[model samples]
Target: MFGSDDFKDQAVWEFSFRIDDGGFSWDYKFKPPLWKSVVGRTLSKNNDVLLLDASHDEPTDGREETSAVFQSRFLEGIGPIKGVIYGYHQGPEVLKATGNQTQLKNWLRDQTGVRVYRDNVRVFNYGEPSDDWLGLNVRRINRPGDRFGTNSLVAAISLDLESSYLLKEKTNREGFDGGGAFPRFVKLVLSAFERFEHVAIDDRKALDDVIRGKGTAVAPVRFLDAMDSLKAGVKSKNIPKAFQREIDAIEREYTELRDVMVSAGTAGLNLAVIFHEIEREVDALAAAVERKLDEQSIKKQIEQIHYMLHGFAPLLRKNPAKSIFCSEVIEQATRVRKSRFAFHSVVFSAPVLTKEEPDFKIKAAPNLLVGAIGNLLDNAMYWTKVRQELDASNGSRAIRVFDSAQGR
Candidate 1:
């Protein structure tokens, strides 16, 4: 059975051979079973196989072993098929010789996942890339661990149940029928995986430590220890204490410099936010100024422009301490309207404050205050042009501004 061409052609990394001949014939070379032949033909060159001989006859006492008992015995160490199972991992030398760890990993990933065979026939849908038959993917996704993923494993479990007559394949070939044996088979595989995961976790941690150079002469702890030793040797030799003192002073200066740089960075960030807010407000004002208005609406638009500018006062000066002359603020705000007023042949006027009604100063942010007033003037200019176009009598537009101490 072992000398067949099929077995010779396939690469078997691991194998378990067992026989329960019942002391019949040691010299007899029985032909490989149907399942073994199928496995030989279908197995990949990188596959593993499990061979069992449960050919022992039924008890003559009329009390046959139950399927559960048979399964238990098979899992235990008493079966004729009992043997040590071994797995292989490429050593560092082999990995270095390949010089393409990525390619090897990709290949292993492609070949990972478990395939099941019953009576020598491959089970469908279990080992496919898209099939998470064991809920391994789900478990990994929900509770991630440094354990095996589908692309990191390749396994197969072959079962021979002809004698027990407890399991049957489904008609669709997806897997075994939902009989008593199916759940037990699944449980057995999962239990084995739980143990495998524990080993894999340790292995992964060891590899990580190696990669990080931990527990080695080049490690951070060792490097610091070496520096301390050098410093002690220098002190023993009575090297210049002045040099060490200078080094300590320089270190202190560097720490203070670092703090200053951090503060500067934080202040720069705040400035950027303030600049962005100002730009957005300016853009909105510009858009309002460019809008078209109807011919007969002149006075109403002027009031709207005033109202809009008034709203901007609060944004300009968040606090009440910053103050500017009311006339000066209005003049700055109306500057945006100069070009528009010229193009439309409109006159812009800012009435001078008389002596009796003193030109009082108001608290406001200069930029925001200017922009708010400017937008109002822009709206007035647009509507004034429209009015002039409609009625030649309104040939030119006029914008007048007045400021009061009461804050209008």
Candidate 2:
């Protein structure tokens, strides 16, 4: 049983950084990429240390120390950079109108990966800035308020999945405008769903023509064209099924296309789900440890996960130990000291907070209990959003929070 105490070991981290780059940068904190917060909670437990020895290992270590190798080696010949990089973007894949849609938006945000940024319409995964350019056109929106209004937040999103049409500009509030890379991806995905919708109607028309033993049904030409477009959407390799409603229409119309289309739709849903989890994992990880990961390595790991399952080997080369699952621990290390005179002994102990507790003090003052409540309220708010576990093996939410006066 790996308890919280098992986690604080210095072994939880690795040691290595570029000497040429001067001291340490963000990447230096995580000798093992997975040891970073992302894998900490969900995976940080020491399961036999299957990778490298914390005390003695180099970055370019051996196979026993790796878990995601083919990620780099296998992708050596995967593409026209544009096509390959773009493939996963849309196949990867949003919302809204008004009324309940807004309520749903809040619910959706709560449900989607905390990494996903949504406001009635768009969802963003623009944090931790990935280092690799896998066809993803990342844009940094630095405080929309300063450039637009005072109510602004700065964020960066990386786009690597491939797609055909993009929502780069705005449209008639119904379809899409297609301006930013994300919008274009959304619009094209929805458009593909539209194509799926029409195919059924077209199929009906064509069937009518054929079954009537004449040109009475719509026309096989029309239905066939629909099939072509549907396949094209599939072939794009983007997060398919972005446009779901259209396919649902098709499912109600033609049973054949519905079968294929539905399967694709499910895959799209799964893609969204996978991405959603990735977003949460990423957000939690990124938020927990800003400068711990090698941005390039994170990019590489994502790409590897995106492309080859075999690639997991090299990806884990540096973090095979942390790539498994998430766990929780409450560990505290303490010490006691006695004076030579022995009148009284002072116990100076650093109790590593586990089981998550508030570390701030509350004092009643004249006329400003309001301020005290405000501080307590603010501290509470921070704790709620954060998953604070102190074990280095456990990705810690915040370093440590200081509570109040102890009753002797």
Candidate 3:
């Protein structure tokens, strides 16, 4: 009775399930971590969803139980895959609908290697589209909005992916990277999204030059190979914790790379081509959106973006020294608010809190956030230039920052 897409979610669950009216549905967020062991074992434990008792093929059919997992068999068999796993919120009806939890468990073990029992955790759906996109990016694309303008609706969707899937695990355990499979799953989802769309793309070679924003999203490259070096050192000495983090990172990277390799089959590419295409498509869309965008309308968008960036700057300067690294937070933001604010022309603001320092340190993993913000700023600037034609006729127009605390 389940659709192909529904099966796809089941294919990926490393082990958790939801409790609902008739039965439970699998949690897609838990799958990617399972593969970490095959590639490079991670130190983090699996986010087990289902508890399984898998049986062997022998006549006696020896059995072993594993609650949280996606046996290889299941992954190969499951269906309706979307671009790597993004956040999935079960429709309330789906939760209430009857599902044979026992039958589902047997199907998983027989088809795939995963198994699940039950847990105290209640299913909580992150209902935002942006949250879904961010979850998609944890494994695919360097980060959200890296391929498009941050202020673009696409960016908002990408933000959701970040929050729902990646943020929590990272916050939960410093070493979950080994067990972290979300990023890898994201790669698979992105590949799947484009795979079915059949949109022939041609210009991704420019992504290299595209500083699409957010520090972590920018493909983290450390100055000193601290992680690698530590790994080697640990190999020589049995330092359990020291090498664990390294192992986790390596496992995550490997899983992500593997997913990308599989997905990139026909469309796989580096940055250059990707960026060029993204730009072209965006421009084409912008041109369509407006014939002659007056200076005020365009300026409002830029101003909003700009103020947002300025607000982030103070936060960047705060303690722990984490840069307001995201492109949006670091760069200026200028947006055209749907409705008029006190400043009807443009509304610019920072995405992060500035001025006052928080008790906890924030690592503004620069690339995704900063890059997205910058994209918006760049677009706003472009609109401003077009709007400036008024100055030649008679008067000079000025732009000012609204958030005084932002120091813009």
Off by over 4 Å in 2: 1-158, 161-367, 388-408
Candidate 3 weakest lDDT stretch, 10 residues: 53-62
Q: Candidate 2 on 159-268: residue-level lDDT in tens?
A: 22232123332333332332323322222222222222222233333322333455443334676567667766766866457555565566457855544454443333
Better of 1 and 3 by TM-score: 1
**Candidate rank order under TM-score:** 1, 3, 2
- TM-score of candidate 1 against the unseen true structure: 0.32
How should the candidates be ordered by lDDT, best one leading?
1, 3, 2
lDDT of 3 by residue, 203-240 (tens): 12121222233233366566246567767788778788
Provide the overall lDDT of each model, using Cα atoms, as 2-decimal numbers: 0.46, 0.26, 0.32
Which residues of candidate 1, in runs, are more than 4 Å off?
1-97, 100-106, 141-146, 161-164, 216-408
* Residue 333 accuracy (lDDT) in model 2: 8
TM-score of each: 0.32, 0.15, 0.20
Q: Is candidate 1 or candidate 2 better by TM-score?
A: 1
Worst 10 residues of 2 by lDDT: 83-92
Could you say which candidate leads in TM-score? 1
For all candidates, the clash counts are: 3, 54, 102
